[model samples]
Target: MGRKEFYWYYKLHATTAIFPTRSDGKLSKYKHLGKAGSQTYIDAIEQITARTRIEALDRSIEALRQGLKDLVEETSKYNKE
Candidate 1:
């Protein structure tokens, strides 16, 4: 299908491409890249996506660990025979 939308203009654009600001306050573009550049552009996008996912998971795991630790500490305070 034709380009229904555009994002990451800064990451993937031709050397001669120009994105101008439109009068309607929407972003305007002059050119889009074909499948002509080196594979590094796509590789970078994948790496960035993976890194973001890993970071989010790490934060979630740490939060769960802290919650469990707090629960154990509170339970240990109960009197025992």
Candidate 2:
């Protein structure tokens, strides 16, 4: 069989029989879709990328806030001198 056919065959047979509950109480079925070319794998990669971008932006905002606070403190000290 070709690679695509093999992937579908594997996916069909690799699924688990049990549906487990997630932390939010939603029922989720387990699928063995960790194969590199699958849609689910691609989605997971995108999610990770988005999360990383968000974290970097948050750090930048915090650094800017700290810089502003330091500038204000310096201004107040100079005015009092």
Candidate 3:
């Protein structure tokens, strides 16, 4: 999801779950599902980190390919002599 969508969804669920209403239509005190909420945030962060790592890895692989191509061309030139 995009930036705005993410914030909306996070706020929506947080509000609904933390402030559930009573039978008489009274809103209860906000209760945090502490560890679970923490875990959710941790998991989201890990996902973002994983994406960053993957992109970095892809760039490194491309760099390696270019370096290897240069090396191979140099070796071929030496063999031609």
Q: For each candidate in turn, give its C-alpha RMSD to the true structure in angstroms.
A: 9.8, 7.9, 13.4
Candidate 2 TM-score over all chains jointly? 0.61
Q: Which of the two, 1 or 2, has more lDDT? A: 2
TM-score of each: 0.49, 0.61, 0.49
> Tens digit of lDDT per residue, candidate 2, span 1-81?
556545331222315544344456554555345678678667766866999999999999999999999999999999999
Top-lDDT structure, candidate number: 2
Task: Give all candidates' CA lDDT scores.
Answer: 0.63, 0.68, 0.65
Candidate 1 residue lDDT tens string, 1-81: 798876543244435534544455545444233343436556656766999999999999999999999988888876442
Over 4 Å off, model 3: 1-37
Q: How accurate is candidate 1 locally (lDDT)?
A: 0.63
Task: Put down candidate 3 lDDT per residue, 45-75, tens digits, no spaces.
Answer: 5766999999999999999999999999999
Poorest lDDT segment (10 consecutive residues) of candidate 3: 6-15
lDDT of 2: 0.68
